[model samples]
Target chain A: MTARRTWATARRVLAQLRNDPRTIALILVLPTALMTLLAWILPDSEWQKYAPPLLGIFPMLVMFLVTSVATLRERTSGTLERLLSMPMGKGDFVFGYAIAFGVLAIVQALVVAGVCFALLDLTVRGSAPLVVLIAVVDGLVGTALGLFVSAFAQTEFQAVQFMPVALLPQFLLCGLILPTEELPTVLGWISWLLPLTYAVNAMQHVVVDTQLDTRFWVDAGVITGMAVALLALGAVTLRRQTR
Target chain B: MTTAAISVRDLTIVRGPVTAVDHLSLEVPSGQVIGLLGPSGSGKSSLMRAIVGVQVMESGSIDVLGQPAGSPTLRAQVGYVTQDPSVYSDLSVLANLRYFARILGVTDDSVERVLDQVDLREVADRLVGRLSGGQRSRVSLGTALLGSPQLLVLDEPTVGLDPALRRDLWTLFHQLATAGTTVFVSSHVMEEASRCDRLLLLRDGRLLAEGTQSQLLERTGCQDIERAFLAIVEGGAS
Candidate 1:
């Protein structure tokens, strides 16, 4: 893939997002707001116990929603087909989207982490920077998964429908709602198949373990590997024309 | 002798159980405005998509600009406009063109030139969503015009345009042809047939005739291209 073409695609995507104020607010504000709301509503002891894992999950959910709908919009509007007819390789389009959303994920992670640390006065035993890293990776995984899912959806409504089918199960089983260790063996085995489990596991380690140890590295590696695999799958599944 | 801009031999495309383009063979000479005239569902758009390398064919082969159709090398030399206007509605007209220009490796200034070519300079900064349908189609056309591609495949670009706008677009097509760009335009409207330097009349996925407006009329002893087309269809049936 040509770097210049990929960069151009990324820039164009960002430019389009700039014009969409609602989406901008959703991308930058929604996760932070949800985190703040949760922090305020929960008791101090429970907040301390739950905040870090919630932070990991929030970025994934928001990025998945935004990227899937946005990419699906391009498909439904026929713009993706038009772009494909150009000299652009499938990698350029997919990577361009990944880079663009990756940048947004960085901003999203930073905003949520900053608010969690500075405003909410949340304490992480592990390195705070590690929390941000896990969050960013979580967002990237969301982006990759969204791109992959958009290929199967014909309309934005159908894309939104994927949240319940593809993402909600991860939320339930990834130790966000119930701890994986506490889950039934069959349910826990299913959690191993999800990328978000590793993201949540890594972030939870940063919150409780106070150090980047073997567990953290393994979880981070799995998350990164899943992101790459999903991105590649997205590239392969992308159609030149909607049939 | 100059090579045909596009050459197809027994091109057949089937979608599900139905044949969309049936063993079609034709040659489009360079630097000419060739119109693909057919009724709706006559495989006009499918034929255009195959030439641009986007549609899969059941059989047959297409050669565009001396290369195999849909070759990566031909990507820069060929431009295609789909039947629907495909510009991003959220983007300004200039931004849409600039995006495509960059993808095509054309200079940034090419965006302005294409906008000017399509008479969209006045609304360059307007969001495509705010533009009229005809205006949006012009923006889509302008995107295809970027880099002055050698072969432009336009599918039903003038469907909803006013008569004057349609005439203006045909003039632009002729201007591009005069500058040595081969234009392959598709339309189901019979009236558009006469505007083309060469015409390929299609029915139910097969070609009925391929010739100039006058040649078609003379061959069928009809005064107008539409009647000429009807005559040929009737004669074939009889």
Candidate 2:
């Protein structure tokens, strides 16, 4: 993809988002609010225990909703088709969106992670900056998946509906409710295949391990690989015209 | 067909159970406004889509600017404005133009040129969502007009504009053609048909008649485009 086109798409998306305050709030505020509510629900120590992994998943869920809905709007509104006809590559459009949402996702990551550490009394054995970094990467993964999933949805309602279908399995099997090994053999296998599992697996090690360990490296590698692969898939699958 | 701005040879497009464009063959000459007129479902849009290299044809071939339809080279050379307002309403008119200008790899000056051309200079900074329906269409027109493409395909561009705006756009079409840009426009308005250098009349995804306005009237023994179209369609039916 050409830098000019990708940067143009990103700038245009940001300008559109700037005009839309409600979507901004949804992307930047919703995660912090949910995490805060969860902070209030459990004891501080117990909350810190769950917060790292939940931080990984929270941005994923929120960015997925925002990115998918926004991308689906481009599809249903006819802009995507119009832009495709111009002197542009599908990667330019998709990656431009990824860069735009990825920027906002970084903002969301910082805000949410800051809330977790300062307000929620989250203290861990490892690097909090590393936790924030993983959270940002989680946002990128969400952005890629959202861009990918939007192709399957025809309307905003359908796009929103995909969140559950696409993410519910990730939540259920990502060692959030149960450790992966404690699950059934088939489900445990499925969890290993999911990026959320690896993401959660990596982030949780932050609270338990004092240093960057080999297991954490493996999980981090898997999640990062998933992000890159999904971004490529999204670019390839984006239709330049109605099929 | 080889030298024309666009050439379609035995092209057929099937959408669901119906053939949107049925074995249609036509040569759109260079540097002129060729108006395509048809009934609502007569494949006016489907044909425009094909010219823009976005539609999937069931058979035959379409060559644009001496290249196969949908070729990478044509992306910058051909500009397409569909029936819908294919622009971001949340952004201002200026923002929309600027973004398209960058995407088309044109200089920043085109945004100002299009703003003036579309007569939205005063509202350039206003969000497109807040503009009138007529003005929104002009924004889409401005998007296509960026990069100064060799072939411009606009579908029903004047559907919502006033007579004054219509006249101005027709003037602009001729001006672009004079500068060696081939403009392919589609419209249902019969009055606008007379403004075209050539016209292609379609019915049921088939070419009913085509020629200059005077030629069509003389051939059908009718005084106006509407009657000429009716006469051609009715005579061919029997």
lDDT (C-alpha, whole model) for all candidates: 0.88, 0.88
- Which digits, one per residue and each the tens of the lDDT, describe model 1 over residues B51-138? 8887878899999999888888888899899888998999999989988988999998898788778999899999999999999999
Model 2, range A1-243, lDDT digits (tens) per residue?
799899989999999999999999998788899999999999977898899999999999888888888887887787887887887888898889889998998898899999889988999999999898889889989988998878655456777788889999999999989999899999999899888999998998999889887898888888888888888888887766553
- TM-scores of all predicted structures: 0.94, 0.96
- Candidate 2 chain A, run of 10 with poorest lDDT: A151-160
* Model 1 per-residue lDDT tens digits across residues A1-243: 689889999999999899999988998899999989989999988888788888888888888988888888886787887888889988888889999999999999999989989999889889998889899999999999998888666556777788678888898899888889999999999999999888888888988886578989999999989998999988887766433
Most accurate candidate by TM-score:
2
Which residue pairs does candidate 1 place in steric collision? none
- iRMS (Å) per candidate: 1.8, 1.2
